[model samples]
Target chain A: MSSATTFLLTTIMISFIINIAISLYGVFAKPSLVKKFIALTIFSDSVNSFAILIGFRRTPLGYPSIAVMPSPPQSVEDLKRFVSEAVDPVPQALVLTAVVIGLAVNMFLVGLIMLYYKYYGSTSTRRVKI
Target chain B: MSTLQDPLTGIAPLYLIAVAFLTAALGLVIRSNKFFKVFAIVNTAIVFAISAYIMHKVVDEGIQLYFFGGYPAPLGIAYEIDNLNALLGLLATSIMLLSGIYSAWYMNFPRTYLYYTLFLTLLAGSLGCLYTGDYFNFFVMLEVLSLSSYSLVAYFRDSPKSIEAAIRFAFTGIISSSFYLLSAFVAYASFGTLTMADIALKARDLNAVTQFSGGVVGNVAIASAMMIALASWTWTFKAAIFPNYFWLPDAVPEAPTPISAVFVGVIDLIGVYGAIRMFYTFFGQGSIALQFRSYTLEIFQILGAISVFIGVFLLLLQEDVKKFIAYSTISHLGLIFMALSLDSGEGISAAILHTISNSFAESLLFYSAGIAIVAVGRSINTLGVLRKYRVALAGIIIAMLNLIGVPPLLGFWSKYLIFKAFLDTGKIYGVVILVLATGISAIGYFKMLFSTLKPVEKIREDPRLRNSMLADITIALCVVILIAIGALYMLSPSARKFINEIGYNVIEGYKAYYAFLSSGS
Candidate 1:
């Protein structure tokens, strides 16, 4: 790999790892349910970015394509060139699905938190015994 | 085009999935309780029929691969139905049908139309998980299963305990699902394909090339191992294995009883099926298994043994009857895992049989316990209060006996098969540990059973049990099925032979699976 590619990969990896660490700390160590929900969102989003990063590929011109096909290449030569240059599309599709599922889970958690507060008159889970 | 017109191969699984999803969507708009109840029953019955037909097709004609929209395997999603999944799909749909009928009386809360909708969605998600051949589709279906289950667990939102359990369940569930997604990303990054059969083919080719160089101890090997480990962790969490099992006891008991039955009977079993499918079908070939087979088997073996011990130990201490049954589920699942870990034809057969028996037994137990709870005026802290309901008490006894593997019940034959598999593998330690676990669990089950049978001086009449005709019919249906299976096993050699064939099919289907992927038709 080139120096620019190595640098880009290293940066993405480090950011994903750091975000995951901090978010996990919030989810497990924090007592507040709302904080845990926020932390969960961060964790999910970071994982989604990691998936997208795996699909990232640098072209010969040193530009990264996001793997969304504009249209199928009509010519065989163009198809071969596109296949070599384009980023993998599968992980990008997976990330799209993950993002939507994450949003739904987050919304459900918020509703549950609201209900928990209404019932127990508190949002902190530390006092709630398992 | 004419080949694609084959009904059993092309549209059977889709019919099973679409019926549930459409019923759920229609239930939401209709908003009538009576209509929702009837719709859920009729819908699950249709799904059950389709599942049975698909299983019959798979047995007679062989593996059925249904590609959605007429797209082939690599380019579009497909539903791969072999004997293993066909049987599991049938088991899951049958339980859903019975529980859907029982829930007509069990779910007496206001706005029960929403319950029916969620119930159907959960069934659809499970059927999708069983049928999908694409890894990304599996992840999406898993999310659908988890989200609907989390909502169902908190359906009785009036109780603070139920909400608490739901939160914990959701938190653990999302974290585990993220691990699954991460594993998918790693697999796709390495293989450049999302279809399981294609991935398996590539992995096998890589293994063939690497075998001469050395065993697969390179970077690719490490990546594949990591993917398997991560995926296994997510599956174990869902299956409620030892370390990841804390949420199960809390979550299952808090849900309404019919939902509890779904959790233990359908959802947890699907989790085990996913793990088994991943190990046997997706990663059965190539460097991944070659490098990590022994280690993976040992990990599952030890984990399964520990879960068996801890689950039964916890069962002995539970005051609440629902929680007791939940812990028993964990213990039985551990046995199934132990069998699956052997990774042989006999072991897989044992696991499948146990899955069948345990699904029916656990659902029967939970529904019967639900009846006792209703008869005892909602909260059943002690078993003494159940003396008033003789009919439910008898059902509970039969169910408990089946769970304990007493003779002449379906559970006994499955447990016998598992023991035989352990002995066949020469895992003496596994056999000894399972025997000890079964012995201890029998004590706990008998204690719960006998207490329910004890007579009380003041026999109070419960209005709920007095009118629970539907629930009675459901429980009776489960008991009859259990007995019938047991009798068929004893009386017929062909029935036993058929189950063995299903097991061998799972073990031998890998070549055909790879052939289809490589053919690229």
Candidate 2:
């Protein structure tokens, strides 16, 4: 890997980690339910992005290709090379599923929070009694 | 029984998934809650039958594998059935079946079709958690299970307490599950695969490749440690251990009693199973994660011991009957985790056995607590109302004794095994923790038992409470199963041997676990 490319990648990865940390702090330290929900959204999407980073790969052509077969390979060597060049589909599929689930859970929690507000007229964490 | 049934292991979970959606669709078309309840009961019965068949097939054969889309391991989703998960399948199905039957009489509110739909979906998600052979599948199912549980917790949407409990449960649940998902990412990034058995094989033999990709590509030790740290937090929360246990006591007491019973017995168990899968199966005997695993397990042991003391102390101070039972459950789960952290064959087996008996015992208490407190309200002082209902009184006694670890009862042997495992591991403090937790929780148990003996006349005039034959039958059945299984454990050698083998095979049977995928590297 070239030094410039390595430096750019390292900086991007560090920022991803920082984003995750900040979102988690928001989730825990924020007092309002809506703000906490927003934080949760960022947290999950950040992790989903992290997953894409895991499965992402580059091709010899300087740009990466997905796991899909662009064209049929004729020889065994061709198929083997195709496998090596393509990005892993598993993590992509995983990220998609995680994002969908995160959406559903976020919707559910928000709905619950709305109901909670109707009962107490506030989304602040202080109003919820044990 | 026949060659045609070879693929039933794969078909069983799919059947459960199909039935979950079918139950949802049935609720929409059929507006009658009675019809919905009966449909759910029948569906649970059939699911139980399928699980029994899978259990039989698994015992006759060894591990069974079914690849989705006929794609080989590591490239497609897989369902691997070994002795451990197959046994859990039977346990989960049976618990839900009993729950289905009991809930028929218990749930009287309108829009109860929604409740039944969520119930079946919870069962489906729990079964998926138990039966799945892939990491991503497990994460998705955990979400399914958590979402349903959160909804069910706040099923009484009008009540502020239910909403409060649901919020606490949901926030912790979502965050914990996301952490688990992150661990899965770390795993896939380093291992180049997400299939569990493939990961297991490669974790032990670093150079081993799956059918689709080469394995252990980068920084295996750090990745494994990260996965363990992330996954254990989720597992501990799901299982309701210390520091992560805030939601359980609140959630259970607010939800309807049958849902409370199922939550304690079935839903929380997914975490224990996940921990075993990671520590014993995936991160098993070799790989470079050994030092990190041992260090983390020690931390887990300390956490488990702390939870035991914490649970018992809080349990004694509880004023509500249902919350008392939930606290008792937390302590039992603490015992299970302590056993799990011991990381020996006997420890795992004891953990598994304790889980079964604890589920039955806890559910038995919650089922009987229904007649004891619901009509009168949640106060523990009203347990004297239970005195008039002879069956509930007996159920409470047996259940309490079972939890308190009376000799020859169902809970005793599992507790005995946990203690023995602790002693064998030279962790004398674990035994001290066990004995102290049991002794302290006993005070709470006896308080409940004695309160029932008092002369409270509030429930004697309630006619609606006297006519619940189905609920009584469920309670009686739990008592009988508890005594029967305990007796069978005492008298039958094969039953004892079978449980021992499951505990033993969980860690040692890795070779056979992956042997089904002969074509995979």
* Per-residue alpha-carbon lDDT of candidate 1 for residues B1-521, written as tens digits (9 for 90 to 100): 32563455545435545655676577667766777788779878877888898888888877788777777776777678887888888899899998998999887667786787688778878988887788888898888888999999999998988999999999988999898988888777776667776766667676432111112223666677778888988889988999898888899888989999999999988778987777777677443555585588789998999999988998888878888888998999999999988878888888888989888988888888887666553333445555655556667888888888888988889989998999998988878987898899988887887676555444347555568789888888888988999899878999899888766766666777657654436
- Positional deviation of residue A52's Cα in model 1 after best superposition, in angstroms: 1.3
List model 2 lDDT by residue over B220-251, tens digit each.
Answer: 88888899999999999999999898888989
Tell me the TM-score of model 2.
Answer: 0.96
- The global C-alpha lDDT for each of the candidates, from Candidate 1 onward, is 0.80, 0.85
With a 3 Å backbone cut-off (N, CA, C), the pairs that clash in candidate 1 are none
DockQ of 1: 0.76
Against the true structure, candidate 2 has what lDDT? Answer: 0.85
The weakest ten consecutive residues by lDDT in model 2 chain B span: B1-10
Off by over 4 Å in 2: A61-70, A74-81, B1-5, B460-464, B519-521
Cα RMSD for candidates in order: 3.6, 2.2
